[model samples]
Target chain A: MALLELKSVSRHFGGVRAVDGLDLVIEPGQIFGLIGPNGSGKSTTVNLITGLFPLTSGSIVFQNEDLEKLPTHLRLQTGIARTFQNIRLFGQLTAWQNLWVAQNSPADWAKRGFFSRWLGGQSGVREEISQLLEFSGLAHRQDELAANLAFGEQRRLELARALATRPKLILLDEPAAGMNTEEIGQLRERILKIRAQGTTVLLVEHVMELVMGVTDRIAVLNFGQKIAEGTPVEVQADAAVRKAYLGGGE
Target chain B: MDFYFGLAQIIGVHTLLGLSAYIVLLTGQVSMAQAGFFAVGAYAAGMLTVLAGWAILPALAASSLLGAAVACAVGFPALRVKGLMLVIATLAFGEAVRLFFFNFDYQVARGGVKLGPLGGEGFRQIRYFPENGWTTMQVMLFIWIFVVLVMAILWWLDRSRYGAVLRAVGEDELAAQSVGINLTAVKVSAMTIGGAIAGLGGGIYAHYTTHIEHASFGILLATFALAYPILGGLGSVFGTVVAAIFVQGFLVEGLRFLGDWRNLLFGALIVLAMNLRPKGFLDAPTLRWIRRVFGGKRGAA
Candidate 1:
């Protein structure tokens, strides 16, 4: 069974048809890459899956559960998390606090009464937060506000926050957007490490080197529709994919 | 000393109102309904004790609960709108509640014989301390104790995960939602808690003054409450506390020496404050400085 399945998903922003008749299946523990030209509905698909926007038609199934009715927060509780294409950390919060807030689950909130919750949980939460800070290489700078961090560090902090959710499947939207080569290499290693930990990844990137180097399977989209899906080499050689990228004579 | 104590009591009550406003502001929500909730608390406690013949402590509790109920009712729908629309919705709700209480009519009759008019004209001459055999000093002490308790609770919340989440929601609702924070729940809870705190203040205000009037909890009071958080700096709880004390406690009262010219002085002060320190006197930088002086670590982010 697929970890995530989107069948004939369509979203129309007043006839714009941002994502039209899209069908996709992401297997469990697989690193799936979604790529497309500008305006090819890549981000829209991510939004639809995460319930950021209501789908005009169709269904999204996650772990055999229909996600049509769940709100974005509920979807997140069900072990799905994502990073924004543009970084959106809580700028006023420290790096440690950013990850700490993300670690909150509805279950944790329900477990204790109001006063206990206000006092914050036991040592477990603190330990987990420390681990996440160390994992993101932000332990030394964890006290710094997120807005003060360098861009690359902010991106890493966001990734760490997503991981703190303990998500079953994580979505990365252009994780390597404005990074140097060294940073990209680090991010690739982190993604591989994330996959090794048994969490499935759905990466959406315009950075071909990162996508091709890291993803197990790749899908190409053009004009709100999937144009190709296969291994990286097969997708690279597909005639339609080549035409979509290089532009044919219509 | 008595005069200073009385002034301190008034300041403490306003501080509670300011804290109530601070609660909603923490979620980046601008609600001008604190006066409405304050009225609910005042009337509920007053009527419960005077008419229904209940004890003071129980009446206070009931008032707080009623305030929370009214807030949740208003918040469920009011919070659905955002920015200025939400402000308008809350303001309208506050007016509607005030009008409801103003026009309320209740009469007790025995066998068609008229008893008394207990509604609409406003509950007056509520002799809370005299009738209960309590001293003004005791009541003042009572109000300040709760003030301290509330401050402690807010301080705890400021350091907790709940506070972090509220700040996140305030900073960026979209991003907060993306992280799985329940925006509606966070917002509604903030409103409910804020209303309860204001209601508690109202109960104390009614008992302390030994009177209740509909006109006292008007739009002007609500607007001043809103200004506390803005002028205090929306960044921290300390900002609200300091702003409420300086503005409501000192500045407003201290300007009375100028008599008729006080309003002009107050207006000028506000304008200057807006121009000179738009973020309020007790903002992040100032807070950091205070922390540094006290040898305390960890910024108030």
Candidate 2:
């Protein structure tokens, strides 16, 4: 069974079809890359899967469960976590607190009673939060407000925040948009490490270098439609994919 | 000494009101319906004690429950709207509550003297304190007891995961929702908690003042309930207490000699305070400095 499946999803904004009749299937434990030019419905696809907006027409199935009725938070509770393309950390909250707020996994609930889950102090999940901070290289900056962190640190914190949900599938929306080469390398290693842990990754990126170096299977989108689907080398060789990226003359 | 105790009682009750607003404000909601909850609590507790002949403590508990119930009901529809619309929704709710009490009449014969809320005439002679022979000092101390308990609970909540979640929701609803924080539950819970606090405060205010009119729970009181937390800073619960003291004890009481001119200074001073401390009186840096001075290492956030 697929980890996530989008069946002919179409979202229209008053006749402007942002995402028109798109179908996608992501297998469990697969690092799926979704690459597209600006306004190619890459973000819209992510939004639809995450239930940020209602689908104009289609069904999104996650872990074999239809997600038509679940709200965004409930969908996340079912183990679909995502990081925004633009960082959206709680500015007033500390970096540690950011991840602390995202610990909504079923396991987390089972670990503590209702009273402890909320009003109880952070002592129970201290180790888990610290580990996430360590993973993001933000342990030293944990006490600082997320807004005060550097841009790179903020991005890492946002990823860490998503991971805090203990998701089976994580979506990274242009996580490398403003990153330097070194940072992108680090992010690639992070994505591989995330996949190694048996959690599937959906990487949406404009940075072809990171996409080519990381994704196991790539899907190209143009004008809200899939233009190509293949491995990196196969996608690179595709004439249509080149035409979508380059120009009509190709 | 009596005047100081009276002032202390007012400050304590206002602090509760402020803390009530503080919890709701933490979720980035600017609710004006707090005064409505407070009014409900005041009337409920007063009627329970004065007419139903119940003990003050039990009456207060019932009032708090009623307040929470009303707030929960309002929260569902009010939270559906955002920003200024929420404010308007809450303001309308507050006015509705006020008007309900304004036209409310529940007087009953008590030893040949009518004793209950009469429409427009107001609920007078809530003599639980005076009749029980509780001194001004005693009443002030009693009010402070609940004030401290509320502040402590909120302080503990600030250190908990729920506190972080509330702040996260306040920071960004999109990110909060994506991270699986139920916006409705968190918001409604905050609203409910706020209602309980405001209700408790109102109960205390009824006993301390020994009277309450619908006019008292108007928009101005609602604004003050919000202002205390806003002016104090959302950094911690203590900010609300500090702001309540500054506003009630300082501005409302201390400047009384200025008479008619005092109201103008009150407005100007609050504006000035806001300008000086945009994040509230106890913003992050100031809180950090205070913590350092007090030999504490942990930051508020």
Candidate 3:
């Protein structure tokens, strides 16, 4: 069964259709890529799926549950998490603290007495955070404020923070937006590793190299609609995708 | 010693008010409605004790509960608006509450004789301690105990998951929301807690002063209370407490030597403080320094 299914979803902003008639299905453990030019509603589709914006029409079913009525936080609690297009770390908090905040979601804990609620979870949470820090290659710089980190490191920190939520499906919005080539390569490896651990990844990126190298399947969008959906090779060979990108007569 | 006790009592009450402001500010919501909550607490406690013949403890508890209820009621709609708009909404709510108190009238009477009205005249002669035969020191002690308890709770929250989520919401609401932290819940909780704290302070203030008035809990008091967290540094709870002590407890009292010019001096000092230390006296670095001085283990920067 698909991990996520969007049925004829449409989101209209005034007269403009930010995302129109979008149908998508992301199966469990699939590394899916969403690629499009600027203003193609790529980000809007992610927003719709994650419940950041209210759907204009149609339904989004995540793990067989209709997500239309769920708020963003509730969607997250249902094992969906996303990174921002622009990095949105808690700037003043340390790198470790950034991930810690994500891991500290109250819904994850069992209802307990006051003292146990306050003190009981520390050791386990601390161990998990340390492991995440190590996984993100940020153990040494865990003490540094997120705002003070290098751009690549900050992006990596955001990835780690998203992973800290233990999400079943992680939507990564342009995770490699400002990274250098080597950093992008590292991000590709990280995405594969995340997928290998049974987490589905929906990557939205303009970086074709990373997408082509990492994603198992790709969906292309143009003018708020899917132009092509296939394996990377098939998408690369699609005539419609070529026309959309080149602005040529189909 | 008595004079110092009085000073301590004022500092404690103001500190509670400051902490009240700090709580809502934690969720990046600047609510002036804390003063409204404070007023609710004071009036509730005053009217209950004076008219209903209630004890001090029960009056205080009722006042705190009423404060939380009023805050939750205001917060539900008011917090839907963000930043400056929310601030204006809360400011308006505070003014509305004050005006309601100003115009409100409640008459207490036996079968035929007319007793005094409670509202428009402002609830007065609320002598909680005198009836109990408690000394001024005892009253001061009582208020300070709650003050310390609140400070301790806030301090614990600073290191707890609840505080982590609050700080995250304050830093970036969208990010916090993405991580499954319910923005509205955190925001409303902050406001409710803040109101309850302010209400607690108000109950103490009513008993301590033996008098209550609508004008006493106005915008100026709210503004000063809000300034405590900012002037202390937005980074830590201790900063708010220290700022409250320095500004309301020490500086305001010390400036009295200027007599009629005291207000002018106080304003000038605030301006100078802002200029000299834009981040306030106890920013992250200062907090780190203090932690190191006290041999506290430092966490990740």
Could you give the TM-score of chain B for each candidate, in order? 0.92, 0.98, 0.94
Q: Candidate 1: where is the Cα deviation over 4 Å?
A: A105-123, B107-120, B133-135, B298-301
Task: Give the whole-model CA lDDT for all candidates, comma-separated.
Answer: 0.85, 0.93, 0.85
| CAPRI quality band, candidate 2 | high
Q: Candidate 1, what DockQ?
A: 0.58
Instruction: Tell me the TM-score for chain B of model 1.
Output: 0.92
Q: Native-contact fraction for each model?
A: 0.66, 0.94, 0.58
- What does candidate 3's lDDT look like per residue over B1-301, in tens digits? 8877888888888889999999888888888888889988888887788778888889888998889888988899999999899889999999998998888777676456433225666776777688789887888899989888998888777677677678889999889989877888889988888988988888888878887778988999889889998898878778887888888766788777879898888888888988887888888888888888988886543
Instruction: List the candidate 3 regions with Cα displacement exceeding 4 Å.
Output: A104-107, A110-121, A247-250, B107-117
Worst 10 residues of 3 chain B by lDDT: B110-119
What docking tier does model 1 reach? medium
Per-residue C-alpha lDDT of model 3 across residues A113-196, encoded as one tens digit per residue: 544444333444677789888988999998899999988889889999999888999999999998888888888889999999
| lDDT tens digits, residue span B207-263, model 2 | 899989999999999999999999999989999999999999999999999999999
- On lDDT, the leading prediction is 2
CA lDDT of B255 in candidate 3?
76
How close to the true structure is residue A176 of candidate 1, measured as C-alpha lDDT? 96
Tens-place lDDT per residue, model 2, A28-83, is 99999999889999999999999999999989999889999999999998999999
- Give me the displacement of residue B85 in model 2, in angstroms: 0.3
After superposing candidate 2 on the true structure, give the runs of residues whose Cα lies further than 4 Å from its correct spot: none
